[model samples]
Target: MITLDLIGIGSGNPDHVTAQAAKAMDRADLILVPLKGEDKADLAGLRYRIIESCVTNPATHVQGFDLPVRDPATPDYLARVSDWHDAIALAWEAAIRPHLRPEVPLKVALLVWGDPSLYDSSLRIAERLAKRLPLTLRVTPGITAIQALCAAHAIPLNGLGAPVTITTGRALRETGWPAGSDTVVILLDAGGAFGTLDPTGISIWWGAYVGMEEEILISGPLAEVASQILETRSSARAAHGWIMDIYLMRREPALP
Candidate 1:
């Protein structure tokens, strides 16, 4: 049996790691890190740095495994993601099985970018692995990009008891703005989803690489800064080969 601890390390900053998360890392028998290709090698490097800072137990083994690229040829979005998750699960088993002992229960940990309960999919991948291995899963909460974005911009998440909507870039591009929630937080934007919106009477707070040394923040009327964000995002991605960003949008008449 494997006691799988999926610890949320938070957006690229070692200081964002909670005490609870550090303790979990220190106690792990083995830690698995995913290598996401050279384009996003910085993400993997950050995980290694965090592990170095927290994993005091010399017995804790660290392992890196290549992440399988999703099949872009798969037409249906849902089908593509499902197939990708399946491949990742297989990759995980191949990485961990070598160190497993039939007689002993293993404590394996993976450092997640943000809270797994949020937009992240590590939890879902773990579920697939559980089907093949005897596993007990535990999640350690850490600051999410939403929290980090708001913190970076020094703004409240919601407007006076109003609800908040959290969605991915694909959904925001396809569905338009959701009703009811005045504040919307967007993640996993491959590009500018905001370009699809009307940008009327809307304000945006945007952050890229929040909590990291390369962090950038831009906030203003969506109408005013949309072009700026698109330009900046392109330049940053070109410079680093990859970029991760999150942004919040709300109706005008700014909340107090």
Candidate 2:
């Protein structure tokens, strides 16, 4: 049996790590860090920095493994994702099994980016592993990108006494913005999902590389800033090789 501690490391900032997450890192026998290829090497490096900052125990070993890419050839998106998760589960099991002992429980940890519940596959991958292994899992929450976005821009997440709908860029493109809600937050956007929406009368607060040193923020009526955001996003992504961004939108009437 293995004890898995899944800790949310927040975005790219080491300070976002919780005290519990820091303690978990010191307690784990093995910490697995996934390498998201050369374009996103900064991600792996950020995790290393977090470990270096929080962990002082030299006994706990950290290991890095190449992440398996999802097969683009799989015609069905849902099926393709299922297959990809299975592959990751296999890799995770292989990485930790050799270090496990039959008599003593092994502590294996994965540092997840942002909150594990939002736009993250670590929870899903962990569920897949549960079916094959007898494991006890513990989750330590950290600041989410949404919170970071709001904090960086100094704006409230929702309208006064109103609900905020949180959805992905893919959903915004497919279903349009949800009805009956004045505020919405979009995450995991590839680029320019705002162009798909009705820019008129809508206000947007967009942040790229939020909570990091390279952070950029833009705000205005969507109509005025949409083009600027699109161009800036493209240029930023090209220059940095990758970008992680999120945005908040609210209809007119100015939430107070």
Model 1 ranges off by over 4 Å: 253-256
Tell how far residue 180 is off in model 2, in angstroms.
Answer: 1.9
What lDDT does each candidate get? 0.93, 0.90
* Clash pairs detected, candidate 1: none
Task: List model 2 lDDT by residue over 10-108, tens digit each.
Answer: 877788899999999999889999998999998889999999898888889999998999999999878998999999999998888789777888888
Put down candidate 1 lDDT per residue, 80-187, tens digits, no spaces: 999999999999899889988988989999999889999888999999999999899999999998899999999999998789999989999899998777799999
Candidate 2 error regions (>4 Å): 253-256
Worst 10 residues of 1 by lDDT: 247-256
Model 1, position 44: C-alpha lDDT score: 90
Using TM-score as the measure, which candidate wins?
1
Return the lDDT, model 2, position 150: 96
lDDT of 1 at 43: 90
